[model samples]
Target chain A: MEMKKTILNPEGLHARPAGQLAKVATSFKSKIEVIFNQKTVNAKSAMSLMTLGIIQSSEVIIKADGPDAEEAIQKIATLIDNHFSV
Target chain B: MSLKIIGQKAAPGMVHGPIFIFKKGNSEINRSHHLFSDFDPSKETLLFEKALYKSLQDLENLKNKFTSIDKEKIDIIEVHQSLIDDPEVKEQTLAKINHENKFAYVAYEEVISLFKNMFSEIEDSYLKQRVLDLEDISNRVLFYIINPELNFSYFSYSQLNDSRPSIIISEDLTPSDILGFEKTKVLGFVLSKGSPQSHSSILARSMEIPCLVGAHELETLDLSKYTDLILDTENSEVILNPNINEVKSFEEKVSLFKFKQKQLFSFKGKKTETKMGKLVPLGANISGPLDIDSVIKNDAEFIGLYRTEFLFLDRITPPSEEEQYETYRTVFQYLGHKRIIIRTLDIGGDKEAPYIRIQKEENPFLGVRGIRLCLKEIELFKTQLRAILRASNFCNDLGIMFPMVSTISEIKEAKKIFNTVKTELEQSKIQIGKKINIGVMMEVPSLAWILKEVSDEVTFISIGTNDLFQYSNACDRMNNQLQTISSPTHEGFQRFLKFIVQEAKKNQLHVGVCGSIAHHPEIMPYLISIGVDELSMTAQNILTVRAQIADL
Candidate 1:
């Protein structure tokens, strides 16, 4: 399952948001990956998510594979859509 | 060639010394495969977790240390805590140790480096600054993994010798790091990273150490090669490997600074008088009894403004009447005949106390503070008054002053409370002093207009120029962005001062000027000419102001 979301935060996906995304990815038994600027990184790894340099207004593709892939995609998509306020 | 690196001047002073590069954490890690050869994968992962736990504990301790004193510093420490708890960084480090069979330190370094590189590449300057946070966390984890046996002291003050003063060159200094070093031994600070508003920078300023922040090129410099360097905060430049002429000029300035100090010291015992032999009473503004020695040493005639709020701040509860009485008694006993004017509790606004329970306001500077806070908390005000009255029994020359009185009714109300306290003390058979002068700090603009009305009620008036300038200019003195407009020397402010002095003289009231503007060499002569009967400032400036007055 795959979902596309725009980075809405004025600060973009910095350390804080990257940590949030990574935390959400680890909760589900699925291999989650975030694709930005033709580069795909493990959504479960903050260092990898950060390396993609996903910035404000940038489009990102979140892909999840395994039994809970659909749920994983939805959770992460909601986070990015909500601009990681929590 | 003398290379000049520019940065924001965090503190003011000039000094030349050998550069001491103090990087936080152990950056030099042995990446050799030997350390990782016998590494049990699960054991290595466990070691990494343990290091993270230790780092988190250290950060928490640091946060607690600064929690009461500085809120901004506590926020910085909290950021580090969150960075350490980031699940991705932890998982990646564990994966490297488990899957790649790398040492814990090496794995941590790789992950930190990856994040650092990514942060550095970000075009946004604010986001790019996060690289420092990443580096700080990585260093802490690596330090634990490499030297588990060695305990780390956040401030490595014991390692440096007192005999050899050095300029600390670092990527960034945490407030804890700056606090650890002896102010005397650390002559200056040169940072590769730090904003002017950083707590470290604020600490440096309070310590009076020359500091230059945001010197990006300092991180790349071969500090070992350049043994001697000049940190000139006045010019906001750091000169590395200065030539003969540069060294000569720097030494000349140091000698001049020393000579000026000596010159000022020569006038310490002499009466503060003009060349024409007109004596002007010079005094020191003290925060507490601790500054009594400085007041005597500086030969100040009296304690002009004893700020009493220090006792109420940084505490869980307001000081009791007995506690306040003891402190006031100590000051009065020490000063003896040297009259100490104690300003009643002036907390609120910038000097907020958590225990005081003031509502958060959009413009706290103009909010319920000083006498206004006291007016609302009547019991607290009465307790302080009773204490002051009790302390007055110890000495003859105790002057009581009310702060932040803008209207005649406020003075009338304060005086009513004062009379009630005095009557209560007398009724209790307390041996109060025969004559205690009552005064008001002339800070509010409205008070200046009604000086004639106030002069009848108060025995003396002390113009607190710090707030007067801020109030008159409608600028927040503490706000760095308003530096240009917040000056005390504005023509309008000068006119206000002149008018107040004139009105004070017409009403036959002893008017003195106290604040930063009081002892300023250039401002002193002008104030004297404008009929300011006395000037009070920090004890350190008494000698300087005396010398300046003598010259006039």
Candidate 2:
């Protein structure tokens, strides 16, 4: 399953939010990856996500594969919607 | 040949010392690693995983042990922790160990360098900063992998063995990395990559260590060729392998700077009185307890302006009464015997909290802010008042100041709320302090002319000159084009301030100037002569202001 979303954080996917996003990704029993600017990185790795340099309003495609793929994608999409405040 | 590198001054000082080229990671591992003839990928993989786990534990321990007053510092540690927890780094290192037949530590090092090189190419500075955090964790993990028994988590000066006074030159340093170095042995720092706003540079400034950041030319220099170095932050440059003449001139500058500092230190315990023997109390304007050390160091007579906005800003929710009370009590407890004047939430204008709902106006500075905002949000005002009144029990001399007060009615409304909170606390048998003074921040220009009208409502007035000057001239102080017109030394501004001070005196209201202009060398003498009762400034300016007062 995959879904597209735009980052709303003023600071983009910086350390704190990236860590938070990764923490949420790690919860589901699925392989999740974030694709930005044609570059795909493991969503469960904050360092890999940060390597994308995703800034505010950057569009990214989140892809998840496994039994819990749909749940994983939905959770990550919601996290981005909240500007990664959690 | 002497090499000169220009950079931004992170801190002010002058020093000459032997140059020490400090590298972050353990370089010994690179030399010791050899071509493995009979390689065991599984064993090496196991070792790598153990190192990673141990490194994570070390970071967790550090995070647990750290009790920093600044929440930002702890956030840095958490970032480092998450950086280590990245599955990509572990996966890449394990893959290298299993497939390429590399040593455990070597595989980890290669993986880290790959990420570091990738991050280095990034133009976004905030993302680029992660490279340093990457290095910090890599150093820790590598240290644990090689020398687990040593239990060395931080890079220390003892590793160098040579104890000669030196200026540390590095690619960049983390806050933890800088803290690990021996302060007495390090004369200064020259970083090839970093900004003055980096945590490391801020730490350097607070530590009073001379540092130059963003010295790109430093990366090109062959450090071994430069045995001696001169770090002159006043000029925002470092001279490596200085010539005989350069050394002599640097020595003279160092002594003169030292002499000036020594002279200022002598005025610490002395009375803040002018040559004419007119005494005035010099106080520090602090945001929170983090600045308490500096406040005591500079020998401030009192905390004239404690901006309480720090507690309100940068958080999603407003601080509860209990949290606010605890913070105020801690500050008051720390500054025992010394009088403390705390200003209520002075938000709006330049500072905006997302939690506080205010209409978006074209001009925020002229819109609802400070006391005006408080007046509208009665509950918010009362909660803060309740906290302050509760904390007053711990303080011998505490003053509650209302900011952005313009009209006499605003002052009356605020005091009325303050009295209601006080009575409520009293009815609950809360024993508040007796001699707590209520004051107003005289930032609104109109309030100055009407000081006498509101004299009975407020006990004291602290002139916030920055806003007063900006509002008086109708010029934005931050706009670079208006710099000349917004100058504090403008005759009208000076005369206006003099009038405010004179009015406060006539009303028997103790007045202090708690703004950038208080420490202005050209204006401090004039203010002293005009009978200003107190001049409040940042902790760093205390001694200099005291010295200036003595010379007046």
**Predicted model with the maximum TM-score:** 2
Q: A62 in model 1: Cα distance from truth in Å?
A: 52
> Where is the poorest 10-residue window by lDDT in model 2 chain B?
B27-36
lDDT of 1 by residue, B1-552 (tens): 678898888877899998887765443543354354687888778778888888888888766665332434555676677778767788888889888988888788898887787768855544565676676667667767765645445324555544488998888887657755766778899998887755577677655678999999877777778877999887889999899999999999989988998888888777889999998989899976656666887889888999998777643346656557777777777785777788998977666465466888887779988899999999889989998888888777878899999998999999999999999988989988767989999999888888889988998999999988888888878899988877777788888899999999999889998879997767778899999999989988888888778879
Standalone chain B TM-score for every prediction: 0.63, 0.77
Off by over 4 Å in 2: A1-86, B1-4, B25-28, B31-135, B146-163, B220-225, B274-277, B308-330, B345-394, B408-436, B474-487, B547-552
Clashing pairs in 1: none
Tell me the TM-score of each prediction against the true structure.
0.56, 0.71
Q: Which digits, one per residue and each the tens of the lDDT, describe model 2 over residues B228-306?
A: 8899998999998899999998888778877988999999888898788889899999987667778888899999999
Q: Per-model C-alpha lDDT, please?
A: 0.80, 0.82
List candidate 1 stretches off by more than 4 Å: A1-86, B1-12, B23-159, B170-186, B189-226, B233-237, B240-246, B288-297, B308-337, B347-367, B379-396, B419-435, B469-499, B520-523
